[model samples]
Target chain A: MTEQRTRRIDVPVLARVEGEGALEVTIRDGRIAHLALRIFEPPRLFERFLVGHHYSELPDLVARICGICPVAYQMSALDAIERLFAPDRQSPPARWVQRMRRLFYCGEWMQSHALHIHLLAAPDFLGFDSAPAMAARYGAELRRGLALQALGNRIISLFGARSVHPVGARAGGFRRAPSLQQAGALAAQAEQAVPAAEDLVRWTAALPLPAHPQQFNCVSLRHPAEYPMIGERIVAESGLDISVDDFEDHITEFQVPHSTALHALLEGKPYLVGPLARLNLNLDRLHPGVKALLAELDIEFPSHDMYHSIVARAVEILQALLEAREILADYAPQEPAHIDLQPRAGIARGASEAPRGLLWHRYDLDSAGIIAHARIVPPTSQNQPRIEADLADALVGVGLDEDEATLRHAGEMVIRNYDPCISCATHFLRLTLDR
Target chain B: MTMPPKPPAIGARRPRLAVHKFSSCDGCQLSLLNAGESLLALAERVDIVHFAEAGIVDEHAEADIALVEGSISTPEEQTRIQAVRSRSRWILSIGACATAGGPQALRNLGDSADWIASVYRRPDWISALPASSAIGAHVPVELELPGCPVSTEQVLAALTSLLAGAAPLTEQDKVCLECKRRGQVCVLVTKGEPCLGPVTVTGCGALCPGLGRDCYGCYGPAENPEVATLAERFGDLGLDAHAVARRFMYQQSGAQPFHRAARDWRQRARPAAPPAPGAESGAAPGPQPDGSTDSHD
Candidate 1:
């Protein structure tokens, strides 16, 4: 008599993901018994500790939350603060600030998306242990990715002194403006990288990506005219549209015992965010050239395949480059880089499309502009539930009887597909199979 | 300037480098990826056996150099840092979080649960140490590269020095030295801006001062920091006690020198006096060129 075999796939270290996490799945009788993605990273309690900080310090303070995407934190915080301080939708910073902010955000998307595709996600597609291992053979391609990433940093540094925890952004506007010569040089370089970025889109699409398409809700910020970086409206492919102010109404956050990060539900279900979600929701908002490039590559948006995220990031890189080149072309430095902020007593709400997903911030401030309450919903926290859902289905696809290494690699690939910023989510990856 | 990924010599072992994380944002380790053109060569120069963020995770792998980021925030982290210490020949704690306990160290002031409950609705579910501390507090560190996110050049410079069998030279002078070297105007003296440059360490190229903002000491305390004198100067600039304490306490609150001064200043903290409506709330203090604060009085 043969006893039913129990399979347990345990990955001691989950690599290529930020922060700390362990994925546990139990399979019995060829039926999924229990599956959970747990984050063991110690809680930093950013929202709680941020209570007493002056609104002026919010940008610098929140930027520490995630090292890779400080710009997103600064932008979301500033959006809420700026909206409260400004009497209207577009004053104080005026059109120039609005344009420059988009340009700056583009830089973030470029660097972040570029970094994820080549360094983080690409290794899985190439069947290499790491990017450096992939780099030895794909020298020119790796060089191009690195150069593009640097270009993104350089563009960010143009407005911000340095990309990582940049000291440039302020509530009203920027701390300093770049010189015309600096902007022009940057514009020219961005123009040159356009071809490379285009090739990146094609190259990613050409990779041997898996055809594991799964149904998931796609959520992102939707702008009226352009691809949403900072948006007034939050949207989902499920036809759920709400004001960014009413974000808490639709999305509810819950704590899971397995993870330090909070798992979130969108209208009581899992939803996807970030590049693919942005593309699925706002494909028309992409640059005409990028849209045309997608058409050229035979890659369609509104794709259900999760592995298409790499391609989505590449397409966005091209879009960001195009946007940066245009904004920098008409570069002119403005005096009084930021507007004088008047402390107002009110609840400030802001949301922006972080490279990972929708980053939302709400701060209750006293008349002194000091924070009375603060809540930050970074993208990673929002994606944890969705990532779990993806893993359950994706793992079943990989089959329960597979070897531990195969299951671990498959699980790693599935999570990395989300580009989960465990650090941002209070997140990491260690796989444990208790079958 | 990147070298091709070729073997150094037959049977020769390249120094193994491992990156470990604790309780901070994964920024400092990211600087290694941000090395851009030189990254491939650097990867070839050293065997990167363990860097979870970069997809290589061999936690127990012995390494010639271990680059550690983040602070000790959990019991699990305490054990992990020790394991890293035992395996590594040289451990370089990078960034303010790892070397100085980072911004999270602000929790070190009291029971972490006090603030933890505020952030998480179910605080009972959270598991963290009573206080966050620098990596040095748990295990002996070979070196400390202090920065909010240590500059890319600083990381390169330190790695270069260590790879050459030498000690990395870090500036022990005040941030005022950086401003002087770049001929940047002193914001504190000229505009009464509460810049931490006079007391904080140099490393950011005096980024804040040149940008017309005060340095908030993201790089931690300088050698023989006169923070008490700097605290007094902040008071002279019309900053209230709470505001002055916040400037020193927020980023690198775990640093000894700044901690002592901030503790002294926090004593005279505000008595919960509400800010008057339309008070000067912005980038600088006192007044603006446009008289935006005309109604404040």
Candidate 2:
């Protein structure tokens, strides 16, 4: 009789994914038996602390949930509180304020994508230990990436008052608006970075991506007039479209014994969100220049190829740069950056496209505008289940007989494709083997 | 000032720099990456043995300088920090979270398990200490840089100073001083806003006040802050006692001075007469006439 073969692989710590986590995979009799992605980061319990705070504090308070995407948190919180205070959809902030909000979001996308593409994910593809190591061979590319990231930070500072955890955004609109001169200066910077972003797109499009195609339920916010960065409805390719108010009803979060970050399921199944989902759902809504560039590059959309996320991020960087330039060209300083509104008892919901994917926030305010309860669902948590599913499937494809390094590398690639913000997800994993 | 002793030189080896995370938003460490050109320059001078955010992993590697971000809020983390301390020659606690337990430290005000129950359906699955604490509380720290997310310039400067065998010089002055240096008008005086600039630290370059908003005290507290005076000033600016307490309690609730001030203001905000039976209502402590609730208690 053949002896029963058993093997276990332990990734003691996961690197470059923000915060700490580990992955454990066990194989028995040449079949994958057990897998777990553990998140061991201590719980901050932001939702609980948010209780008893004033409505005005929600934006700033929620921003602390994730440093990499503070703008997403602020935007979501503002949307929810503003909807509650101003139920009339017609009475949204002035066109300029709305435009500035998108522009601010553009900065975040640029900064986050640039960081991930150059510093975090690129190293994996290049077979380097880290970006610093890659810099030795790709010096010019690294500089361009940093310059683009710096430009993003500048734009964030112009509106947010600081790059990380910006305090400029408030419940109604913003704490203050930048002057025309300031906006013009930023526009000049954006113009300078446009060529670099174009180069980035071309470069990423040329990368040697692995062909690991798989069916995915792509999810993103959708709007009628434009590509959705901030929108009212959550749409999925699998015939799932619901109002932001019904998000909790559609998506459920459950705690797994192995991970501190709660896993999320859409209609009781894993789904994907982020650049790929946004592009897939709103290909027609992309800017004309973006479409023209894609056409020139002979690239197709709605592809199931996960590795193409790097290229998608680069395309977004270009789009964000162009959009920022256009918005800043018509810059005007508006009075009353924020409108004063009395908070009333009500529940409100907000959702916006963070760099990674859709970030949703819900708040319950009391009669006196004090927060009675708060719930925040960051993109990373929503992607956690999807990442695990991708891992299990990819491992099966890679075969259990492969070396542990090969399996670990494949697993890291899958996780990094989602740009998982473990800090935002509030967890890490410690892989242990019992063989 | 007398010059400090120069760090001993290793014959042929560069210093190994390691960055550790506990419970933070990852912003403070990102500041190092945000340094851009300066960070690359620093990388040339030192070996980055471990920085998970940067894709570098060397968990057990010994470091010459260890920059720690976030606060300790779990038993496992407490053990991890001690292990990091044992392997490092110098440990510099970075950001508000590492220096004063961060905004999440607000959980220290109430039971952490209760907070978990309020947020999650299965609180039994959660494992956390009762209070979030700064790194210094568990082990010795060579230095502390305080900010909600520390400024990138400060991070670069600290690194440069350390490389040059000098102590990183940090100013302990209030944000008000920085505002004055920048020739900016006081939002508190001009707009009658409840700014914490007078008591908050200055590393942020007076960012909030310069943007025409009140200082929200993201830098925690300055050295020997006169919190009672600021509370009195806030009271004069139409903030009720509860509101005044909240200003101190929100961001740096775990810091000693801020924590004490919050408690003192809450005491002052208490009603002169006890509430009648059935009047508790479970409503937040004080309700202002302006339709805002001040529920610090």
Candidate 3:
């Protein structure tokens, strides 16, 4: 074998991403030898911190975990605490309130998905280094995505009172439900967002996609009724069905050296979790339009080529917006914002579809409504191993020198495929392959 | 037009900006990207020498503006933070983790080694430091922007001010001030809820109180927080001392002053005194007479 030249494409700064991380690739004999997505964010130990705190304060406390998807955290925490109050029974929250909360979570997905698709993922599809550059060519598309994201924020602000880490989410339910007019206004905003979302789905579908199918264990919440949101059972790509309580049994967390976040293995195997997982497991649960759109895009599971994450996110954005409009159209003002909760003094587990993927929460509350112990598994941590695996697989057969721009671009594509939240890793990007 | 006055220089590197990480959720650094329109403008002014989350390629030794997020946990991070401090001219710590060890600091109260053993199947593979501490504990932090995921606007304001050679403005007052200003009803007094607003810092702007809930204290403690007095006040809100103390130990457990005061109060409030000596002598050292003992005395 002939010796090959290698160059280093070190990302001192990562952009359009939520957290901090670096991507390193190595080349030997003109073939990709190694790739490591190093996420060095300090671990805040949120699970450790939740110990000794009151159950009432957990939603707000953990809400600080992600700036983009605070509602997801808030909703999952509420679900867990609510389980303590009514473990075997359904919640007493008014139907309208439940409807509104689901809509609120949809708003989060719309904004987060649009931002990821347009500002972060779009650059890779277009031949640009960043969204700012992409904007020069597709200003209308960028603006439309911004509008869609802004509409999602508007809905969140309606019931949540603020877009990021809203004050409304609590152990019981929202502190205050939006007035009919406020809900109506939000619904109106989302109504306008549907077309833009549809446009995004179509645009993303038109992009060049690499066809490679990697066996993946897609994990998500399974709901028999409407698409799973705040309520459902956890399921995986491999026909493993289990309640959220069995999550610890199925997926075990282990601390790895390259990343600060503890990665989880499903039955000692690396698996995939995120939008793709959700769409694949809940294909029957989506809004008809979204389901049709998914079929149109031909995005069935076990497919390799992580770039499809962008397309999946875009489709979800459309579904979220469509769901938001429906919930808002039937807005009812007098619904109880919360159901009275009495902590059951037992371990309660809850997992919700966060914009990124399944956000899992386990709370061990005491008799007096105080939290005895807590375990939180953010989507990013669940996806860590899959990210490393994909990077390794993508690196194969590529003959670019490690320092070569092509190798670096391929490395980023692998990362962007999972839309890996390295900030969630250190704790969690947009892409450009610089030639 | 004087070329926008060429950003205020710190050193030969045109203030090469380097973003560093520790034990954290990377939320605070993401605040930089969340800056949106303002970020593009800010990027033009600063060299943005190194930001891994946003993907810039610059040597760590060359950064001038070092934005450190998260807390120090691993031994490697201890050394890495020092290296970061040496490289950057202005080290601005962002978020609660950087300023006061963040939520992860809860490990400082317990044995982190035990935590690793409990969480991981093979603890030997896990290499971590004994405790998690704020970035300022090791290096001189020129400024601090404290929050769970430092506020985006605050990040922009701090960077803009620093670039203009001005001191960053901060609300050192308590969250109570923002709540009162907003005319939100006191959740603790009226609703009989436990609140940290009286003593906790005010970055979240009394958001929880405005929603009829108590403050979770994501912003950490206020300047010169009278935590003991606040703990006493919690008694008035129908909470026991233990319940009151639990608030400070929640999200901002790393805040040394607040966490220590709370723990001390907890240790002082035991109703059960130690058991008699011979009554449980060979029985695993029963409680001592005073209730203060080395493993039940």
Candidate 4:
């Protein structure tokens, strides 16, 4: 008679992700039976709390959703509310306003991506307990990464006054505009850091990554001429294109038993978003210099491998640095930094690519511009389902007989690849096994 | 330019520093990582034992100083905080969420269960406390740093002070004091803007007022805030009673002074219709009971 045994791998607390979570995998008779990326973080209930706030307060209020990507939240809220104020979209915002918004977004991408690549994700690749431990060996590399991040923060401060939860962005535009001198300083810093960003691309590309290529349905915003950052039409690799207003038709969120965060699925299946998706969908839209650098480095494009996100993020840092310099060079102090507008009763939706992935917001406003109904879908929440699907696939190859530490490390690596901001998800796994 | 002095070594064993999170945006903790070059320097001086965002998890490790972010909003978190307090030598509550329950504490105003049911389809699966509370409510805090997201320089200063065996320097003065020092014109007096600088705390370098806008009070309340006076002044600037109350209650809603000021304005905004004449005069509606001092006897 053969005996059947059940083995369980439980991670009580997942480290390195933005917020609190756990992973529980149950192996029954040498096969993966159950897997859950449980997010037990206490729900902050941001959507409910936003119900009674005035439209003018949305920018500052939504920015508190996630610290690492406050700019993303503020920008998305502004985009949504502005649409309600100007439904025609015939009179676009001023050229200066558009340029400044991109500049602010560039700062966020640089700071957020640099933090992920250096401090959060690098430890996994280097076999260190943490970034501080990795710093002892890779001090110079870490220094360059941090310096680039500081430059990003400096640009944010130029417009927003402070990096974290900046108050510069409002409904119509920024509260104030940066002078030519401030722009000049940012330009000089960006120009100096361009080489470092380029180095980061090459450095991350050279990291030892496990090649586990699989087809993924990539989704991101697509602009006609520019690399999509602000607001644009949503595009998917599987021939799905829709306006921002039509996002609810294509993507649906549902509650799961184990997690507080609602899992987002595209057409009833897991889909990928963020840097990897952005690059795969908009590689041609990248700057000429960025394209040339990619070619020179001999890295293949349209990669299905999830680990390539690190390299994609590095490429984005380089692109952001170059773009920031160009914008700063062309910047001039424009009069009336913001245009005043009165809010009317209407419903609108706005979506933007956050440092992590697509962040979408919808608002139904009353006649007095008070929020009637509000819905926010952060990138992390959308990515949670895809992360779980990827984990299930990755763990199948690992032998059931492997030690617990090795199994847990493999699981953590898989989760960190998405740079899951469980904090943004606001959203656990406890393991129970039956033998 | 002179370089800042290196952080002095405390003893033969490096002092362990652990950072814990409860319910926050993770911005305050990120500020520590965003210190860039100085972060590496600080790393050399102290042993960072537990910082989950940085991929270091040692929750049970004893530490010399523990910097905690966010607020407690769950039963599990409530128990976890007590455990954190037991293991740490000194606990520094960082950010507005840790010091004053943050913006999410607005849920304390109404029923949290109703809020949860409105958002979630299956509210039974969700487990949360009725109110989001600051760390001080759960455990004794050695220090409190207040901000929507704490300033990185302030974080470094606090860490440096602890290493040097000195108290962290903080200004108990209002943001108005910093605005004066920076030689900035008062937005409230000159522009008629409803700035909270008069009652808000310093440490943000009077950022909003410097940027040609009204101060939104991201750094919570200052010592001895004349909140009623400021609320009345905001009303004078064309903000209605409700708007004035919101201004005080927005970011640091859980703080005692801000909470009281907001409540008072709410009462003043719509007085309760004089309580229907003699309803509050202790008059019996249907039948009067016989008034007797020794009825039982």
Best by TM-score: 2
Q: What number of clashing residue pairs does each candidate have, in the order they appear?
A: 8, 8, 35, 4
Q: Give each prediction's root-mean-square deviation over alpha carbons.
A: 7.4, 5.2, 7.2, 7.3
In terms of lDDT, the poorest run of 10 residues in model 2 chain B is: B288-297
Q: Which numbered prediction scores highest in lDDT against the true structure? A: 4
Residue A55 displacement in candidate 1 (angstroms): 0.2
- Tens digits of per-residue lDDT, candidate 1, A1-435, equal 435867766665678887887788888878678888878878776776676678999888999998889999999999998777774546645668888888888899999988998889999988998898898788899889989999999988887888999889988889888888989999899989999999999999999999888888999999989999985899998999999899988987877778887777898898989999999999889889988888887666789899999999998899999999999988888887776777798999999999998999998988778887777888988888888888888888988777878888999999999998888887311111212
Q: Which is better, 2 or 4, measured by DockQ?
A: 2
Per-residue C-alpha lDDT of model 4 across residues B225-276, encoded as one tens digit per residue: 8988888888888987657867875678778777767656655655532321
* Model 3 C-alpha lDDT per residue in residues B221-267, reported as the tens digit of each score: 88777878877777776776656656776556667666665556555
lDDT of 3 by residue, A1-435 (tens): 766566555654455566666777665565556666666665555665566567777766777677678888888888877765773345445455567788888888887887788767777767777665565678788778777877877778777666766677765667787788887777777777777788788888788766656777888888879777875688876788888878887787766556666777788888887887777777778899887766766556434456677877888888888888887898776545776666677888888988778888888876766666677788888888888788767667454533356766766766777776665544311011122
- What digit string (tens of lDDT, one per residue) describes model 2 on residues A328-418? 8878888887666767889978889999999888888767676766777888888888888788898888877789899989888888898
State the lDDT of candidate 1 residue by residue for B5-98, as single tens digits.
2221213678898999889888898889889877788988999999988888899999888899998888889898999999988888899988
Q: What lDDT tens digits, residue by residue, belong to model 4 across residues A1-435?
A: 324878899998888888889999998887779999999878887876676568898877888888999999999988888766873444444556777889999999999999999988988888897888898899999899999988888888888899999978877778888888888888888888888999899999899887788878999999999999988899999999999999988888877889987788899889999999999999999999899899977569898989899999999999888999899987887667777787888897898899998998898887777676778888877888899888888887566667878888988998989988887876311111211
- Residue pairs in steric clash, candidate 2? A20-A428, A21-A428, A21-A429, A22-A429, A38-A428, A38-A429, A39-A428, A40-A428
Q: In model 1, which regions exceed 4 Å deviation?
A: A1-3, A89-93, A427-435, B1-12, B270-297
> What TM-score, computed on C-alpha atoms, does each candidate reach?
0.93, 0.94, 0.85, 0.93
DockQ value for model 1: 0.37
Model 4 lDDT vs. the true structure? 0.82
| Model 3 stretches with alpha carbons more than 4 Å out | A1-41, A87-92, A133-135, A253-260, A292-304, A334-336, A400-403, A425-435, B1-18, B59-64, B163-165, B269-297
Count of clashing pairs, candidate 4: 4
TM-score of chain B of each: 0.86, 0.88, 0.83, 0.87
lDDT per model vs. reference:
0.82, 0.81, 0.70, 0.82
> lDDT per residue, candidate 2, B66-142, as tens digits?
99999988888889999999998888889988988888787666555555655555556677876788898888777
Model 2: docking quality category: acceptable
